[model samples]
Target chain A: MNPASPAIDTESVTALLERGRTLATPVLRAAVDRLAPPMDTVAAYHFGWIDAEGNPSSGDSGKAVRPALALLSAEAAGAAPEVGIPGAVAVELVHNFSLLHDDLMDGDEQRRHRDTVWKVHGPAQAILVGDALFALANEILLELGTVDAGRATRRLTLATRKLIDGQAQDISYEHRERVTVEECLEMEGNKTGALLACAVSIGAVLGGADDRTADTLEKYGYHLGLAFQAVDDVLGIWGDPDATGKRPWSDLRQRKKSLPVVAALAAGGPASERLAQILAADAQKSETEIADFTEEEFASRAALIEEAGGREWTSQEARRQHATAIAALDEIEMPEKVRAQLVALADFVVVRER
Target chain B: MNPASPAIDTESVTALLERGRTLATPVLRAAVDRLAPPMDTVAAYHFGWIDAEGNPSSGDSGKAVRPALALLSAEAAGAAPEVGIPGAVAVELVHNFSLLHDDLMDGDEQRRHRDTVWKVHGPAQAILVGDALFALANEILLELGTVDAGRATRRLTLATRKLIDGQAQDISYEHRERVTVEECLEMEGNKTGALLACAVSIGAVLGGADDRTADTLEKYGYHLGLAFQAVDDVLGIWGDPDATGKRPWSDLRQRKKSLPVVAALAAGGPASERLAQILAADAQKSETEIADFTEEEFASRAALIEEAGGREWTSQEARRQHATAIAALDEIEMPEKVRAQLVALADFVVVRER
Candidate 1:
């Protein structure tokens, strides 16, 4: 509502994220080193610190978005970025914890352009490592042993509960034939928004920001997370399989009720009707049949969804959320530098390619 | 190490456990009620508060032994049992969280005379709900907003980490052809001992006991956990399927590297050699072959383990650990009644039939 924005540059955002990874890595590694063998090895591999054979290597870990947000939020609260290291590492651990479990539960076999933890170590190991990381997140925060540390932990636990509840909703929605856009957004809020919101707020909490200030930061991050997921949903359907490193129409193949699919179905047009009919037929089939559906089957559904304006709707929604996230930054009194970094991240997350 | 023990009555121990459940159930339910939709239903079902059809039905939710220990530990610290409710619920939640995941990881279909959560709700819900419970446990402790709550939470996280580590070790041991008595016990200590240790001590910490008293109580609980698990291993191989609600020779069928199996292998006899050869051969088979193994195959291995003194060794080990646990109780100063109750629990855990 306030800004006539200049074009956001990408290099500054990349450098900020790189800075986050650099600062948080040593602490994160030291924590993982405390883990015993097998878990240590597996976690290292998942973080792209080692090759599959357990030798040192380098690969894509992630963009370090949450860590960057945490650090920036701390600075926003008038503390050094270093004050947010625990918050940064804690959120990163949680993000990966969810990923390990989510991959196994969703039956996806690859992540970060490599075989997933479950695919390589098996589902049991995936579950164990994920649980361990979640425990470690709380441990890191509480090890600080400050009143603020306990306050941040309470926020984290709440976010984690919401994150888990969202996963259940996501799974349940896959089986149901009908889902409204509102319901889909609510699920996304719980699934992705909660953690990102916590990422922004917990750092402030850790930096001794009062609840009101932290709450404002949380609002910014929540909208940013939705924007992030909206872009992901669009990419899941229309992005290049080679570039995205996923099967074509991956979400449709899995019958995932992502934003685009749900929005398309709710469009109430001829293409939407056909899409619903086909999805219903697919639902009635056995698990094997649904799993073995041809490439053409999913590709056709993607086309129908596009014809019903799902893709256009989702892209627009992402932009809207991105703008709302920026507006949220105005509600809090932050250094212009910190707000600029936050805005850069929001813009990058909404539009960045894989 | 301690005076000659008086005979402990089963009724008193049962009454203690029942009291623990009665005092902790409402708080546990209130915490669980905070979870959203399908998760709430799934968790309720897992706790035996509801039947498979979501109907209300009372069923076995396990012994509530940890809760009993927690409440009693608070009493030992000269606080009322109500002071331990948070510790009691937290440990119970962690206990059930492990069970839900372990049932899926170990592929066990039933527990406490009912189908396991994973078997009924699908593997995904099991993972998600288990995660929710773990988060909820931390939330319960931290919500008190007291320094003791933070202290208790730290202990709980450590126990939870060790618990996850134990699960990994347990899974890995099953794949190995040979496991020493020492290794098996180490794994059991991690898997079972850590949480029990936390349960007994966290309540005291919550009740404002000093570290020395909590440490002594922790030692007692650790031995008790090992004793409890030793009994469980014995039952897994030799107890009646009807009483235990498990398949015949359940541990052998699953090729579990339990104390009995390892002890028999370490016994170094003709039967032990045969058991090792059989297990090695079975390990080389495909997953389907292992899954389809006949009753006779498992029964034969059980017979070999028993003949090689595995079963007898485990039983004696249970008694030894139980005695050690009782001795540890003498290390701490407490009311005679609390010590007697602890003694009774130790006595019952070591020798009770399924």
Candidate 2:
């Protein structure tokens, strides 16, 4: 496919995302205010609207990637953007809920250049906030103004289950010493990819696309999720600190059994032995020591990933999935411009650095 | 008010619970198989179905309180008892899910007279089991065969939110030094009471009650829950370990601001000062010294509880709520014998030991 034109700039994406937040904020705030007062402060902290002392914090809240993808998919599939707003919010809430809990379970103290909600409010309060947001997400989904709220909720429920399953796998893998490459991919697919698939699928459903197209969009999202995870795995090991807001090679230091590392270990040889030694070391090593390995080392590791077909697997898989997603959008007979924007949006996921 | 007729034996409740379990076993087992395998061992252990080795263990599973309430309410509200089987399982799963997380968050290592899921499987696995159970609960709620699955789901979602809110309040109170009596009441109302309300509401819905009647049953269950909590508060400070399975005076030792303590403190007098002294002295006392307080001291504390109107107020509140709940059931036009059974169940909440 042709690369997105240079004219598609950050200003436009930011503007679009801001508009989405503007529309969604009131709806979500109203429901949350009515439903969960004790958790309100923590929820606000997660959204970056309030600081630790319950004061305002000024900045962009989050990337808003999931919500935008959801709304754009709906619009591209020919549904009016407004109709899909609830679904967009639902997906975003689910995404954020996952984020809130993930930080706690992963024992991560910081997120987006700030102390995580758990760090600020404690895990107990943070858990309530996450659980509240998830419930509110379902509430919003029920308000999708569709006759088939049941069907919509059923899908939402299934997506959430996938999310939890993915997280379970992600956490389980951390304690595993002999994880396989296949298992790592599956974990990423569940943890990182399932919600994205749910996002597009919800959009397609709300857009009134027929069954076949909706299924294809789901595939598109599932593979996009896989690709997104693969790229994220790469970044966890080698991403620039300024861009990622994380210590470089943090995953390696933690011995996170990410796809790339799992691939290297699964190849079975010297590279595997080196990987094992690093993982099994007596104490934590400095970042420099971990990152200072030879080009031979990096290449061998990368080679293992390549041989195991992670990179090619993710890219080719993404292309095929997006093709299906695009085909689904076409079948719905969406405006060409809307379809183009959706394509640009899907493609952006593969290349996002932060 | 009737002294829980000796005829309503544990064996009958167990038999009914067993039947419900048998009916819903396949869906529950399927969900268990699909969502978690590592947890399979842990969950079986928690349920007292298997030893640590994943082989069978010998014992009763649990009291099965929520499921029994669901089935009984369904029958009382006029659905064939069999019709609400799935609802019964759904409530049981949700109940157990809450227990798994509560154990981890509270750091309690025992549940159901067995090692808690978290204690056996660790926090991470316990978290996953909780997640899996939530998914399974929603999945089972969808199978209620109530024609409008969306409504059933909305009820479940709303109930889930209330449950989370209750939990949030409970945990937040642990860190606060001077929680009010009203706040304590609200916490139990949300946490323990909401699920009871849900069981009744779901039963009514399945049993062909209109929205008003269903809401009434829910309200009744809510009152029952409050009464249940009041009794539980009394037990926390005075419960026999052989019966309650809790450490003696656990709430007092933990400085738990239960209804009686909060009320006593809020009354503000000599007794309140004495409570403050006890709380302060409790901080430095050895276990033996803490236990060495005179029987007169215990009597004085009970008198303080009475003086603050905590005991009288809670009992009156329970009676009023029970009456309101019964009135709601009456408005629903439930059968007379069934209504008597419902009344019996509500009365059991405030009176039962195990």
* TM-score of chain B, candidates 1 onward in order: 0.96, 0.84
lDDT of each: 0.89, 0.69
The TM-scores of chain A alone, one per candidate, are 0.96, 0.82
- In terms of TM-score, the best-performing candidate is 1
Per residue, candidate 1 scores C-alpha lDDT tens digits across B61-125 of 77789999999989888888889999999999999899989999988898888999999989999
Supply every candidate's count of residue pairs whose N, Cα or C atoms clash at under 3 angstroms. Answer: 0, 0
Query: Scoring each candidate complex against the real one, what DockQ results?
Result: 0.78, 0.52
Compared with the true structure, model 2 gives a TM-score of 0.87
TM-score of chain A of 1: 0.96
**Cα misplacement distance, residue B128 of candidate 1 (Å):** 1.3
> Where does model 1 sit among the CAPRI classes?
medium
Give the per-residue lDDT of model 2 (tens digit) for A1-354.
643222344555776667677776776666657656658877877777778788888744766766666776677567777766777788888788888878888877767777888788777666667767877887787655354444555666777888887788777777667788678878777787778887777776777766676666677677767767776777776677677766655565556788667766666666566656656551255646756766565555555555555455545544554455545555555567766666666666556776
Q: Tens digit of lDDT per residue, candidate 2, span B31-103?
A: 5666656766666676677877678777456555566667666776678876666676677677777778777
